[model samples]
Target: MGLFDSFSQIRNILKNIDLAAVHKLSQKVDLNKLMGTVSKMSEEDLAKMLKFMQAGSGDKRPKPEVNGDFYDLSKTLSAEEKAIQLKVREFMETEIKPIANEYWNKAHFPMHIIPLMAKLDICGLTYKGYGCAGKSSLLEGFIAMEMARIDSSISTFFGVHSGLAMGSIYLCGSEEQKQYWLPIMQRMEVIGAFGLTEPEVGSAAAGGLTTTCRKEGDEWVLNGQKKWIGNATFSDITIIWARNPEDNQVKGFIVRKDNPGFKAEKMEDKMALRTVQNALITLTDCRVSEVDRLQNANSFKDTANVLRMTRAGVAWQAVGCGRGAYELALKYTMKRKQFGRPIASFQLVQDLLVTMLGDLTAMQTMVHRLSQLQDGGDITDEHASLAKVFCTLRMRSIVDHARELFGGNGILLEYDIARFVADAEAIYSYEGTKEINSLIVGRAITGESAFV
Candidate 1:
């Protein structure tokens, strides 16, 4: 080969090799002599030399596992708790991850997976009795993270059933009500939905519920609409929060799906969490018997208790969504090449990843402590609200960075980062919005009411 052509091949091989290895080789050998020797070599010899250097370029060491738990917080769980976490992780990875994009694209919930999820026996996991395992809130937080790591829609579905719906009954139901519903709901034989958000009232639901209930004889007549009611399309019962005209206090009722005046229409054309069947529910004089009333939920304070408990789970879901996107982006960078080397090796790409990991690790630690407070019975509205606000805000940034790493392909569903980006929007708004949650924390810190 000509000397110029040989030099060109040598430069190409060096570009593909690790720079550190080449620097070490330069220290041991004379570059002028090396170039002269290379100029004399045949094409077959040059190929063999290129292959040898590539093999010696430190590529033989196994790549580290791409775990999003940068801090290894899962190691803090007990052996049994870790086992349960792994079981849920396995279920999500095996059953949900494969079909996440397809179901999301079609905007249809995989009904068959409900039975499969039931087999996991995770519903009502934290409650003390009535078919529950009485697990710790920390473990429950981990479970929430695991579910959203695969698909946030499934996480939302489970959170609505186990956290909001069953939590209402567990916290506000009478002895008789709890005996009848908790076990069946925990076993997944019957599903539940939470109805609190109304057509016009969301942040002001504490005092401005348009859904009204009037008592007459043994039944309460409910008249209003509930918007963005998750799982209401197929839920057997919905925990409806309405204002009582008698005392102007919000009350909770277990309204059955078969109630004559109750109707739920599937909300369509949602850009996010499409696999979740959110419903626009209408209650035209919905008659719920007084027997189904949550006897303990006489006011909005009781409803706030349920929200306070579940908001921590929502924060955990944000962590899961961020973790999923971060891991996906990290994997993509390592495989996607730019110039010559993988994009992951680039300094700019590494900076984005480190920033994402910093935010994710901070979120993980915050929620870990939040669950500890909950388990210790010290969790407050402000505590949950802070995590909800911070984690979700960070989650949006993480998903954005993830999508940016994918460049143009980020918007494609086939790439998977697009789903995370889209789903992050829903997570940011649900359970509580940033402004509302920030005000909750603000009220707690300053001891001054911010609501007008």
Candidate 2:
């Protein structure tokens, strides 16, 4: 090898030494004098000394936790919030990690784990009563990130039940309705789903829901199709939104699964988020009792209230997926060897890793502030829309960069990065598409409507 290459190899070997060993060595010998003596040695001699040091120091220092929270955002959380964050992380790593890929590959939900999840007591976590935790939105966002770090589909399943479906009832349901449904759903005894996106209306759902509702004496009949209803296939209840035919205004109803007119079929053959039980729902003459209608959800604006909260959850999910991918890449680079050294020892590989970490830190800090706004009651639709748009875009980029770091193994599901790659796409499209979310912010800032 040339002299330059020899010097490079010597530097690489020295960089891998555990720093604690150097500290201990300073106590035994004068570090300054020792370094001065070493300065006269050739690269070959330096390499020999490095091997000796490494052999002695292998067990002396523990590597830091493989984390993507570059700015330590979790530390900013209160003690209770921090505890809940760790609790959820432990749960995901212990329970979900083992079966996440298996369930994803089979496109099936693990129904048996529901009880274990309920014991976590996280459903409807942000609401005040009905056995809910009444926690701040910041805690809720961190918990969402923890779950997505392990599995995005499971996070989606929880977000729909806790944020969207339950939030609708909590925000718009009558006092009786909240008392009746919130307690059971909070315990997850009754699973919930949200049905708002339709086959023809996704980004245009605000003004374009094809579903219609008509009041007939004591019952209101609903007729329409809802596509991509999360948790609906086997959920005990679903929150369906339809337009009032008389006034052209939107309304919400809590539709029980076994209602004669309610039908849900599992959507099959998905490329991403396969473990989430998304369903195609048909409400044909679906008769809902007057009492079942959300007492306060008289207009589409009520629906927007629920979406505003859930959109933040989506942004946090994107952060989790990106964080998971970046950490996986970091771990892989440390072990996978290319030229008699770990790939991570190379400078170019480290540059990529740093870039991933930078993007992840930005996304993490952004969501942290978003959650704060939500808890402080200062959040707007535009606040959530900005995060939903920017974070998901950064998340996609992080996953792409992480996948490239894995090289050929990136495509293999067994290695884990492949799952994050596929699942991030699902988070990207759900909640609100990038274009739709951008317009929400656009209209807020410029006071001009760009949405068509």
Candidate 3:
């Protein structure tokens, strides 16, 4: 071939090769000498070289599926349970995921989606009667995971309604109260909130609730403030826990939203879980009928029963948050190119991904066993507390690593990883902080009370 004709053919061949590969090749070989060698090559040899270059120019293997469930724990669920899990997942992806960042950014609750969520018929999932599904706690845990996987704030709303509010009525209310409230709540017609944490009391709520309750004739008066009450701003009814001074024992009262003396001001400017409408509740001489009083909840121990059950669900939520962040980071790394290749191809990136997966997998399996214990009716305060402590702590780490993987974009809310990072902070602190939960487990193992 003529030298000009050969150079023309080589230019065409080089155009098809990856730029990064060509750049590397140029760094190693003398371009002038390579051209001289190529100019003398036969047409058949040139074609073979083109084929070899094309073959080695870029990755050709099919990419691995981005799944955080490395152990496939969902397979252990029954077919029916799996269906419910997938249904919730689909709902979150379709309805919640698109608006998650938007709503989270605005720090506003998506009130319009509540009706859509109600249609799932998952409210009061584990309760046996009063319009509940009577499903296993394992199924309930999966549902929580699915919801939080897409958005943690929505999960918190649902947990407050179904797990805490309805749970109080189911566990501590009179038979009449359960029969009356659970059906409407199950239908999502009457939203509920749990009011336990006070402005001055959170971890010390068991023994130091300053909110006072007094019984007078047929009306019981509740006078106290509750802080950080999720769903309180819009909840139809709130289960208010207050100290009855006469007995010095904590008691629960179902306070209606329209009561003249009850006011719930939305707590604003939160850095985490912004979509949740947490409230600073003020109960100035709020009078409830004797019938509204929780007949079975005579003391804080009854309240703790509700907390023990809900805390296990919180652990599952941490798994969901971590799972979401890990999955997002994994997908981002595969698409985000560095040095003309997917960052996922690099050793350090893979190492970080594996570390996140390890923490996520461990969190999932721990919550899986936690739900099993709950299903078998063998759950304890320490059991739930231990899961909550470990899972939330690991969730914090996973989100941190995920944010790190995104570099500067991690802090920008548009990337969604930023939301996971901020939300993880709230989960780490709420539903009983790590210190309190650890002490619970510590007390269990050592048989020694650490609270002074």
TM-scores of the candidates are 0.89, 0.88, 0.89
Candidates' lDDT values, in order? 0.94, 0.91, 0.93
- lDDT tens digits by residue: candidate 1, 260-352: 899999999999999999999999999999999999999999999999999999999999999999999999999999899899999999999
**Residue range 1-452, candidate 2, lDDT tens digits:** 44566556556655776688668867999967976777777877876775675566452346567889878888888898798889899889999999999999999999988999998889999899888989989899999999999999999999999999999999999999999999999988999999999999998788888999999999999999999999999999999999987898999999999988999999999999999999999999999999999999988999999999999999999999999999999999988999898898899999999998998999998999999999999999999999989899999999999999999999999999999999999999998899989988999999999977
lDDT of 3: 0.93
lDDT of 1: 0.94
Best by lDDT: 1
lDDT of 1 at 355: 97
- Which lDDT tens digits does candidate 3 get at residues 1-452? 55466566557667877789778989999988987887688887876775675466542558889998899999999999999999999999999999999999898999999999999999999999999999999999999999888899999999999999999999999999999999999999999999999988999998999999998999988898999999999999999999999999999999999987999999999989999999999999999999999999999999999999999999999999999999999999999998998899899999999999999999999999999999899999999999999999999999999999999989898889999999999999888999999999999899998986
Using lDDT as the measure, name the better of candidate 1 and candidate 2. 1
Superposed Cα deviation of residue 394, candidate 2 (Å) = 0.6
TM-score, candidate number 3: 0.89
Would you list the rank order by lDDT, best first?
1, 3, 2
